[model samples]
Target: MFKVGYFYTDCLVPMVGNNPYATTEDSAAELSINAEVYSLPSRKLVVLQLRSIFIKYKSKPFCEKLLSWVKSSNCARVIVLSSSHSYHCNDLQLCSCPFRYLLTPSMPKNVQNKIKSLNWKEMEKSQCIPGIEDSEFCVRIPGGGITKVLYKESSSREIPMMVLLKFVSEGDNIPDALSLVEYLNEWLQIIKPSVNDSTLSALPWKIPSSWKLLFGSGLPPALF
Candidate 1:
């Protein structure tokens, strides 16, 4: 099961496209929850989208409740797809790759093993303070927006959660989203493996119609 973000997760839901074998709608009056549920029986996948504008105070409680629901629903694990500010990339992280992941301490052993088998690079352990010897190395996301909170909450509750993200900056982010999906597919295989990078890149991915206006009609004709 996945609770993908509408924007920061690289617009993953739209990339998943629409229509499934079954569907449902769920909301909570007390929590300002509005979501559309999609079920793909053949793939045994369920997606819950909570894409409304975020208010910090409201989102804190909302995430708490959502985690509780996930626990009750017997979800095997949670994978959060998000991005980090490219500027936050450190020298070590920059040298290795733009991608990194964090696994909650309580993730299943088998799950942990599988991730290892893939030879994926885990986020680097870096100095908490540049010159403080006793300071601990910790994970930080300067502009990750709610991702840090969700990871902390899930970790505290012992929920098996994994976050996969890239270091990126604002632009025509459609390409970023596509690149992100390709990264995710390396693990999930939501789309079948292809013969080559070119073939793999050609896999049909549908972007939301809303994106037609992503660039906002361009440069106003560059009036001189």
Candidate 2:
């Protein structure tokens, strides 16, 4: 399993329990935690949440103690949560030190491609369309499967676990949403699969009234 580290402030702890993905100490995670931030729904929520956890009890020793935690922690990636007030895109960025990575779900290939087609860049320096940014946490695999976890490094110990996010393009093609259901359906074949059954049951989300107006009663997506 990937070791994901999340640091949020104590103030937001109460609110996180409401998140469908909110993790807890009892989970089989590498670690579950609590943190502090200035307030809820921050202007710079994600970073502020990290800051909150960094100086939870006091603000005096912020930099020094955080650096120590970074050096000692065995986490591979960081997951930062933004306050409800955030209105920007769904993405994550890592700082320059510690050879670290940031994992933000929904940063899928389709989203990236759509962003690029519109000539938007993920960061300020590069246009989203022109660059292929680095991300170790989520890797893409061809032929419609995702390699989620490669547990061990050695050749003999290595294990490959595949996850299908959604389906693909054009003529005689599978509908994206329906294909996603099938993709997830394949997970049943794996030994101790990562996905739980509840998610599968939520196969199709009820389309909002606004979305119905946009897509004309939920038409299946055709590949471009």
Top TM-score hit: 1
Off by over 4 Å in 2: 1-60, 84-224
Local distance difference test values of all predictions, in order: 0.70, 0.30
TM-scores for all candidates: the values are 0.75, 0.21
Off by over 4 Å in 1: 1-34, 127-134, 195-199, 218-224
**lDDT for position 193 in model 1:** 64
Residue 35, model 1: lDDT of 55
**Model 2 lDDT at residue 61:** 41
Clashes of each: 0, 12
Q: For residues 152-203, write the lDDT of model 2, one tens digit per residue.
A: 1111222111122321333332244444433333322212334556454334
